[model samples]
Structure formats: C-alpha cells, structure tokens
Target chain A: MSGGYPKGRIRREDLISAAAVVYGEAGYHGGSLREIAKRAGISHAGLLYHFPTKEALLAAVLERRDAEDADREQLGVPPGLEVLRRFLTLAEHNARHPGIVDLYSRLAAEAVTPGHPAHEYFERHYRDARHRVRDSLRVLADTGELRPGVDPDEAALAFIALMDGLQVQWLTTPSEVDLAGALRGFLQTLLTVPLQP
Target chain B: MSGGYPKGRIRREDLISAAAVVYGEAGYHGGSLREIAKRAGISHAGLLYHFPTKEALLAAVLERRDAEDADREQLGVPPGLEVLRRFLTLAEHNARHPGIVDLYSRLAAEAVTPGHPAHEYFERHYRDARHRVRDSLRVLADTGELRPGVDPDEAALAFIALMDGLQVQWLTTPSEVDLAGALRGFLQTLLTVPLQP
Candidate 1:
C-alpha cells in the first residue's frame, strides 16, 4: 500500500494526530477509526494498514500524546516548591487545549473499569503522579515550606485530589472554573496554613 | 401503549430501574437501551413507547436514581455539620456499590462535553451540590463549628473537590483507596483546624 516507506510513517503519524482529535471530541467508544481516517485524508484501509485495529490506534495515540507533552514541557528534574508553580503553568496550558484535557478526564473515568482498554494507562498514571507529587511535598517540608505537623504524604494525596476533582468540575462547566487560579489558591493555603493533622 | 392503565407507569419505573443498572455497569455510550428493555422484561418497542429514545431513557434513569436516593436518605433539610457525617455514610454506601459509582463517575466525565446528553445534568448537579455544601458549611461556621479564618464558601469548594477526587481514585483501585477513610480524615482536618487562608 505504501510506495515509499517514509511517507507511510508520516501517514501513520497523521492518523494518530487525527485520531487524537476524534478521541478527544467523541471519546473512546463514540470515536470511529473511519472518521479518523477521513480527517487524516486517507482511506480507512490505509489507516488500518498502520494501526491494524482500533485498540492499536488508541495505544498509539496515548503514547504519542504523552511523548509530545514530555517533549514540549521538558519537565525534567524537580525544582522543589517551584515545581508547584509548574503545575499551574501546565494547568494554564491545559485550559488552552480543553480537547486534550477533556479526553484525558473522560478516559481516566472510563478506565476505572479494570477491563477498559485504557485501564492500565490510568492506573500507572495515577500511581506515578501520586508518588512524584508526594516526594515533591516532602522536599517542601524538608525545606520548611510546609507548616508544622503537616505530613507530606497526606498533603500530596489531598493536593492531587483537589487537582483531579477541580478538573471534573471544570470540564463540566468551563466558564465557571478557573483551573489554574484554584490550584494557586490551594497552594497558597498549603504555604500559609499548618494544614494540621 | 398506555390504554389509560397504571401498568404503563409501572413499566416506566421498571425500565428506569433497569436502565440505571445497565448504565452503571456499561456507562452511557456503552449502555444499550434495548438491553435495558430486555432486563426489564419488556419488548424493545414497548420500551420505546415508554421512552422515545435512548436520551429520554437516560434522563429518566438519572431522575429516578436521584429520587430514590433522596427518598432513602431523606436528604431534604440540610443538617449542618451532620451533613458532613452523611457524606461519610454515603461514601461507605458507595464503596459497597461500585457499579453505581463507576456509572456516576463515567457519566460525570462524559458530560464534560458541552454537547453530551448528560451535560446539563452534570452542570446542574455540580452547581447544586456546591451551593448546598457551601450553605451547610456556613451553618456550621455560624454555629462555631469552624475555627477562626475559615471561609465557608472556600471550605465547601475544597470539601466537594476532595470527595470527587477521592471517588475517582477509589473506583480505579478500591483496595488501596479507602474512600470513606480518606473523606473522614479530611473532615476531621476541617473540624480541628481553621484550614488557614
């Protein structure tokens, strides 16, 4: 089907990008691979030649989105309290791209089902994020940023919960939620209050 | 289909109950109204006669779920700080019913899309929940339950966020997440501290 190998790779990338948009808009079950093919300006068969199946396409799309985000953010080595500010920046970035954020929020909820295609992705995502955030909070506590008696691990859990919970509300009523502002307010509280145990 | 009979009303109730089960298990997009009809022991045509379309059936199911919940809990007159205790009881009850919780989380996420069938339901749900929780928190603050510097509105927002955030993680990894325990911990913090601004 491909006269040139490089072009075929490019086509595959195009399909994944298009599929991301479709998945973001329609969600996993509601999204159609054929519709993705149309958006990518390729025959459905040609799209299948690269992805082979909807599950394969989904995996590829998720993988690519993560890779692209890591590259764009260059989110390397933690910077302690400064790292919290980075989350606000990321939230601002996400607000600009509601489609991707909506897709993620929707999939995260759907993946609660152990058998859902994206189940493993979400489980790993939450576990890693939780540990990383906890470690960062510990760094703050060690540096005397957190108030006395505030357990870093507990703070981490509550902080992450606030972020995720705000996302759910934000997605439902975008106009009513100031995603980054809410996080900023919470961070200020963490700094100012003892957040007693 | 009705023939001026009470049986039609009973059938509608049966269909809504069945649909709730189906939706809870498979989510809105994954759920099939026909399957709901089958479970209700009614023909597909009869189901349609009762609920003209899948969206109509979804609305009915949601309405019934709300009504039954209100009846069971009699959550009409907000009982101030006791309302916080009610949330813990509700979380414990939810822990025993993963299907409904999963369904709710899934639908809440799905309805993030402005055009989704359940979008209005979620938007209204959040607005109402936030207001009610805020109002109850104010009652507590007025009764000297809250410490100095505590803002009822801010406390309400954060409280709701924690409950929702905990629900998402709990649904994914039930054994690791003690939903009620987490909420209880947060509630204790709210009572013991000012949650400094």
Candidate 2:
C-alpha cells in the first residue's frame, strides 16, 4: 500500500534514474556502472545490490522511464488533441533527460536484433502507443471532432512516426529542430482539431 | 584516367564498398579490420593498403554510404514527390540489406558526440535534405499543389520527421508496419496532392 522503503537501502528506482542519466550521457556502450554509482552517490556494491547486472540496470532504467512517462501523462482516456498535446509535452520534457533519450535511441538500434532483450519492450510500446493514438482519433471521429473519411490507423501511424523521427533529429541536432513546435504544427494541419490557437 | 584497376591489387573504392557492407553488418564497435578484410577477401595488410586504421575504415564506410546515397538521389536539384517516392523505394530496397539500416541506426545514435565521425555527415545530410524538400514544396506552392497558406519549411520538416520516425517502426516491426504505404499516404494527405489516383 505504501511506497516507502527502508532508509539504508539504496532504492532501486533511484539507482535506475541515476543509471539512466549516465547511460544517456555516455551511451550504452560508453557508460560505466561505476559512474552510475557515483552519480547516485552510492557505493558500487550498493548499486549492484539493487541491479545485479548491467543489463538488469539498463532494463530497470528503461522501465523506470516508462513508468515516469506514464505517471506524467496520467495514462487515462482524454480528448484526441489533448492526448497529442500531452504526448508532445512529454517528448519535449524527455529532451531535457538526455540520458533516457540516448538510451532509447541505443536500445532502438539494438532492437533490430531478433533476440535483443529490449526488442519486445519496443515492439509492445509502439503497438500499444499506436493503438492508443488510434483509439483517441476514433473518439474524436465519434464526437465529430475529426473530419469524416480520415483513416484513424494511418493518422496514428503518422503521429508515432513523427515522434520517433523527430527524436532522431533532436538527438542529432537538438538546437536546430523544435520537436514540440514541429509536432504541434504537423498535427494541427493533419488533424481537424487545432493543436495551437 | 583509368577506371579499371591494373593488376591484382584491390581498388580503394572496392575496399571501401566492402568495408561498408562489413561495418553495416557488424556495427562500428562490433566490426573489426579482420572481419572487414575477411569479407573483402583480402589479407589484413591488403585491407590496410586502402584504409590505414580501423577508425579510418569506419569513417570510410560512413563516407561511402553518404556519397552513394547522395549520388543515387542526385544531391543538387529539387525533387518533388519523386524524392519521397525514391526514399520509400530505397528504404524498401534496404530491407534486403538490413546491415545498412543497422549501421545507420548505430551511427545515428553515436553521432551525438560532437567529434564523432558521422556527426558532420548527418548534420549536413539533414540540412541539405531539408533544403531540397523545402525547395520541392516551393515548386508545389508555386503550382498551387499545396493548400493555400501552408508553410513549406514546416511541411518539409514534418515530412522528414515522418520518414525518420517511420523508419524506426519499419526497422522494429517490418511485418506490421507498411512504411512506404504509410509514408505515401501521409505525404499525399499533407500535400493534398493525389498520388496517381
């Protein structure tokens, strides 16, 4: 019932958050467990106590990120445009967490391997996210907020594509691309509802 | 100037092409000069005869891929929907060579480092591609192909973002996501131009 934990134990979630920062900054191949431990202000032994292996640590980092994102978005039904607005906001906010973004990119590339540990996570993430977006558009369609004849599935795919694509650009050249603005404009033009007034 | 190599020595261009394939398959970190030489059907010394070091070989691989892509796309002139069409073709064709896609994804992630070899290539790539797309949209605008008051730059950015984003999906779940179809639909809808209806 309570989220509280023992005072002495380095909380697993805190260790994962710190690891995410390190992994994001240094990349999966470049990051070191010692550095993550240092960042969390804990001994390496303490860090290992929470995550027995580097892979476990990385997995925890990704899960923690997803949980945090879910928490921020409230993970419930909402208006179509509102859902998009919240998604864009979360994406922009994610930009500040360079570690998580970098980790996401690295894991994405690795996911190409059929047996990669993160492959299922990414696959399920995209599938579920696409369905969520499609459902939102369906709601909009039902409410007459969306123009008739629009394919909700295609629209959902486009939205997902834009998010993934912009993240690459943002990672490549963060200064030049305005992730949120571009998404807002693109969605406004694509969808019936205006993303911005 | 002789286009053909004289004698048994492998041409530098040939060596670079082979290296691209090897690196594309194994990744910059996972790949090695030995593997590249093996793939090229040459001795280690012969491989070094072209690219002196592993880093140099990696750089050559990325450079060759860029040059090949540019040459294929014909870097200078503005292409209209043809550009998107060509991109889709290339992406679909690339499905046969998963190595290239894997290499690109890997390099893109590592390209975050300012001094990384692929950094400049991707930066100029995005900028140049953006300009080309924008120019194409300008042509569309002048011919009244786009809806009135549509911003070409924003449209171009969105198009590129869509391509980048969908590629992630294509790479992740090629079976489920029809990348080219999704892209063509999104572009047609965004530009309000009928695609050979």
Candidate 3:
C-alpha cells in the first residue's frame, strides 16, 4: 500500500499528510490548495485529483488523522486504566502533530454552525470515544480497579474533557507547557487502580 | 465611564462588541466592516471612526472580551483554590458566550504567525495567566492547602491545561456535555489537600 504510487504520482496518504502540515501551520482558512500542492511537490490539479475540493481535503485530512491515531494507539476495547493509557499516548502523539491539533480546534469552532460537515464528525467522534472510555471504566469497576460506586460515565466525560481542554492551551502556548506530562500526571492520579505489571 | 458614549452616539465599546460578534460568526476574513456596521446599526464610516483599521478592530474586540471576563469574575490575585474557582466561573461564563469563544478560537488559529496582532496577545495572555495561577498555588502551598512538597508550578500548568483541553471538548460537543460539571469534578480530584470548608 505504501509503494503503490509512482515516482510522481501523489499518494492519497501523502497528500493528506501534506494537507495536515499545511492546515496545522496556517489553519484551514489560512492555508491554500496551491500552497499544500507546492509543499507536496505536486501541481494544484494533482492535489485536487485526490481531494476534489478544499472541504473534501479538510475532511480527508481529519479522517486520515483519526484513522492514523487509532492505528498508532492500537486503540481497542481495553479496560479503563488501559484505555486511559491509550488516550494519554494519543495526546502525546498529538503533541508532535500540531497540524491535527489546529485542525481540531478550527473545526470545533466551526462546528457551532448547525450543518458544518465536521459537525457530525465531531459529534459522533465524541459520542463513540466517550462510550469507549465509559466501557473501559465499567470493566475496571467489575475488576475492583476503581473505587466502589464511581460513576464511569462522569469520570469518562471528565477525562475526555481534560484531554480536549489541554490541547487548546498547548496550541496557544506550546513553548511554556508540557501538556502531555501534565495530563499523564493527572490521569495517573485518577487511575487509583493498580496496573498489571 | 458607563455614559462615555453620550446620548445617541454609538460607543466605541458597542462597535467593538459588534465586531466581536461579526468576526466570531463569519470569521476574520469573511467578516467585513460593512457587515459589522450593519450589525451595529451604523455606517461603515462610523465603525471606522472608532477603529482605524480591521486589525485595530480585532485588537479591541479581543481586549474588550478579556476586560469583560476580568470584570465578571472579579478575578484578582488570590489563593490557588480561589483562583481555581474564578477560573471555573470565567470558563462557564465564556461557554455562555459562544461568540467570544469563536473569536478566541479564530484568533488562536491565526496566532501561529509570529507577528500577528493576536499572537502577542495570546503569548502574553498565557504567560501572565500561568504566572498568576502559579502564584496562587504558591499561596495555597504556604497555607497548607496543597499536598506537602507538591510543585505549584506544575499543578498550575496542569490545571490550566485541563481548562484549555476541556474548552475544546465543550465547544466540540456542547449539546451532550456539561463542561462546567466535568471541569469541577476534575479539579476536585486534582486537589488532594482538603481546604477548610
């Protein structure tokens, strides 16, 4: 799958990667297709071949990021603590991908509109991610990993909120803060459950 | 100061407020002076009379929002717990003002440029805000409201990160999540040392 593109043929994944970099640096509105193409070393037509429009390209960039994140984390139906670990790992990875962070921030602001394309994506993404976290907490509860009578749903929501909130701070002040470390410390404290060594 | 505009004169504050709303809804590029004037029930000349340029208008909008936030929270130098309470209150207030949130998001995205007007605003905003938070934590530590030997700076950074990360999530999924409740819960857990209730 990696080697299928010819020497000059812009691979879909490569195009998306380039788009992410451009979007991250300049924002969706600030970035231009021509610039993304220039960065990718391809013509505008060539870039548009993979992504028909800027909107499509933005959606593709976000979708590819989500898929890559899932793959990188190998995120699965793990127990709560394990899920928390995966979530933190993903946040750490996002620290390196400022583009994805910016894209998420931009889309989030835009999502306030009733029918933005990314609106449904963000909505479903949160819903599913929250459910996964909740299920993990349930497993931890069953195994006595969490304190008795802890509300998994609330805990999961708080955990997700923490992750989401930190990214915004990181974007504005990347030089002064270690967002991943902060989150890890907070999560470690929350996960009173003993880890399987 | 409240009557600074005089009767029937559109105050500078009113123009700034209208600019914030226009920029928040239509984005900086998409928003125009004419539209802002229309929103303010004034002519374009009237809008420009207060703000010499679009950049000036943007700066005023951002500054005005910050002032309003500071006034509403009555945020001042305080202990860590008090700082946390003020931060949470301000965040809740911000959540209610989706327009300001949107404007901040847009400006943050634009701030990637080293010399963008909002760039300095954000850089100093975070630096000063973090310093204030750290100072508050130091006070808390001195009063034994923090766990012994805990790093106040790290705690401050973590709390700020949590707020920023949570705001992103809240904006992304406002319909389904109670951002204030989630933040309160997270902060409660993060504070290991019990204060005198």
Candidate 4:
C-alpha cells in the first residue's frame, strides 16, 4: 500500500470515506458516485480508477469497518467474557460515530431484500455476529457466570437484537436514549457476575 | 369517500399497496413514483393526480399503515400486560406479513438521517411506541407482575430494541429466526407470571 503508490492509497481512503458519508445520508441506491467524487475532491475517472464500480466501493467500505472492529475489539483474543465486554465497549464506540451507525442502519435495512448487492454480506455479518456472542455466552455458562436456565442461543439472539434496535432509537432521538447505559442494563439481567473493567 | 366516486377509493388503496412494495424494496430515496404507478397499473399522470409528490405519497402510505395497526391492535383499549400480549401476537402477525415488515424496517432505518422525508415521522413514531410499552410495564409493576428491580424505563427501551433488532435478523435469513418465539422468550425473562393466551 505504501511503496509503489502512497498517493494512490491516500486517494482511495479519501474516496471510501466520502462514499460512506454519501451512502450514509442517501443510502446505496440513492447515493451517486459523482457526488462521492465531488466530496472526495477527485475527478470521476480518478474515483473509478480506485473503485471500478459502486458495488466494489461499497464492499471496500464495509470491509474496512469490519477490519476496524476486529482490530479494536481484539476479537477472539481473550475469548469468552471479554468478547461480551468488548461489545459493550463497541456500543460506546458506536455512540460517538453517528456516521458509521447511519451507514449500517440504512444498508442493513435495504439489504433485507433478496437481490441487493449487500444482502449476502449482511446475512453473513449477522450470522458471524451471533456466533461470536453465543460463543462468549457459552464461556460464561461454563464458568457459572451466566444465569441458570438461560439458553445461550436465545440469549445471543436477544442480545444482538437489543444492540441493533438501540441504534435506531439513538439515531432517531439521541437526546432521549442513553445507548451505552441501556446496553449495560440489559447485560445485568442475563448475568450473575459483574462486568469486569 | 364513497359517495362521489367509489372507484377512487379502491384505486387509492391499490396505489398505497403498490407504493409500500416499491418503497420497501428500494427505500424512499431509491423508489420511484413512476415505478409505483406502473406496479399499480395506472398512468404516471393519474398517479400524480392522486399523490401530487413523492413525499406526499410516502406520508399517505405511512399514515395508512399506522391506521391499520391502530385498528388491529385496538391500541389504548384494555391497556396493560394485555398490550404486551398483543405485541407478542403482533410478532406472530408480522411473521405472516413480510411486506409490512420490509416497509417498516427499510423506512425506519432510512429515516434515521436528518432531512429525510420520513425523519420526523419516525422520531414521533418511536416516541409513541416506547410510551405505549412503558405504560404496559407500569401496569405490570403495579400488579407485581414485573420482575423486582427491573426499571420500567430501561425495560421499555430494551423491549422495543428487541422487536426492532429481531426484524433485521428475520429479514436477512428468514429460515433461522423464529421471530415470535424469540419475542415470547424475552418477555418470559421480564415478567413474573406466564403470558396468558
């Protein structure tokens, strides 16, 4: 990324960031590549040189977000309770990044239909997300940290659901919702032990 | 509505239904008025005569859906845990109606951004929705049905989030999620008594 084309790398990042903003505001279908180029301070051909198509740009954007998450959470590093703890941290992280939240909320909603470009991406994303949470829950269950009679599978679904659902409300009316606090309160209901700092 | 032109009412219904499908599939920013007109089997001019603008059509579509929900749920009538029960029933109902779920999921997510056509509408919608759920929880608290130490305000936020979050998962991979069953299990965790049929 640095040796042959350092300027190219910077330009690509600029385009992706600008694309995220446009797509976040107007959604994938409604967002225009021309507008993205304008926002990125590049020509249309220059933008296309980096991302051959709009779908390709979207894929890059989505991949970058996941990579940032994986790195930030150190996912699968310590495993178990730490993963769940990271998710709470993730909620706190998301509260400050409204642009990222808007992008995800819009794309996930649109991708529900069968033929959307990102449909399969989101399906896999949620499946992986659930698996990660459920694995941590299993760890808690084995350690006697999880409450008795709590099904890991069901709890995972509800946990993931709560996180996703809270974003919508928070974005709609940020003044009314304490996103991180609500998430922490929810976790207290499922576990017997305190979340370690 | 019926006296002057019975045909007008039926045609309007058809347009609204078609608009829902188009908007659900592509979202408000991406969905086209022409496409809606085509799907409803009417001329573009005829569609414009009824709708005037895309934003106006969207308002009608949203208003109609709310009216149907209000009618079906008998909302504000026989309030309390019954309202919660009705929400469980509503999940069952939503399971049967994918299109309705699609419309709501897509619109709500898209409306998160400021300046979107349906932005304020969703702002008010979530506010009213949370209020209804909180009122029901208050009733449960008074009757000693709510779990001790469970804050009704926090519980309401989580409840709404669960419902909203479940829709995205269900829509992404329908075969994997049992929307109504998951909702029931979450309610079990919150309430002391079994939900009465």
DockQ of each: 0.66, 0.60, 0.49, 0.85
Preferred candidate (lDDT higher): 3 or 4: 4
Residue A105 lDDT, candidate 2, scale 0-100: 77
- lDDT leader: 4
**How accurate locally is residue A139 in candidate 1, as Cα lDDT from 0 to 100?**
82
The CAPRI-style docking tier of model 1 reads: medium
lDDT of 3 by residue, B1-197 (tens): 45455733556767877888887766665578899988888778877877778889888777877888888898874556877788888878877876666677666655645666677787888777778878887877777676664577776776665566555556777777776776676555545664224
Say which prediction, candidate 2 or candidate 3, comes out ahead on lDDT. Answer: 2
lDDT of 3 at B100: 69
Please give the CA lDDT of all the candidate structures. 0.77, 0.74, 0.72, 0.89
Task: Name the runs in model 1 displaced over 4 angstroms.
Answer: A1-5, A192-197, B1-10, B193-197
Please tell me what DockQ candidate 2 reaches: 0.60
Looking at model 2 chain B, report the run of 10 residues with the lowest lDDT sum: B1-10
lDDT of each residue in B1-197, candidate 4, tens digit only: 44346788788889999999999888988899999999999999989988899999999999999898878877665658889888888888899999899899989999887788899999999998888888888998999999899888888888888999999899999998899999899888888998875
**Model 4 lDDT tens row, A12-99:** 9999999999999999999999999999999999899999999999999999999998899777555488888899988899999999
Q: Write the per-residue lDDT of candidate 2 for residues B1-197, one digit (tens) a residue.
A: 35356533446766777777765544565567787777777788977877888778777777778777778755444567666666666666666666777777767766765677677888887887778778877877887787686788887877887876777777888887886788777667656677544
Worst 10 residues of 3 chain B by lDDT: B1-10
Task: Give the top-scoring candidate (TM-score).
Answer: 4
Query: Of the candidates shown, which would achieve the greatest DockQ relative to the real structure?
Result: 4
Clashing pairs in 4: none
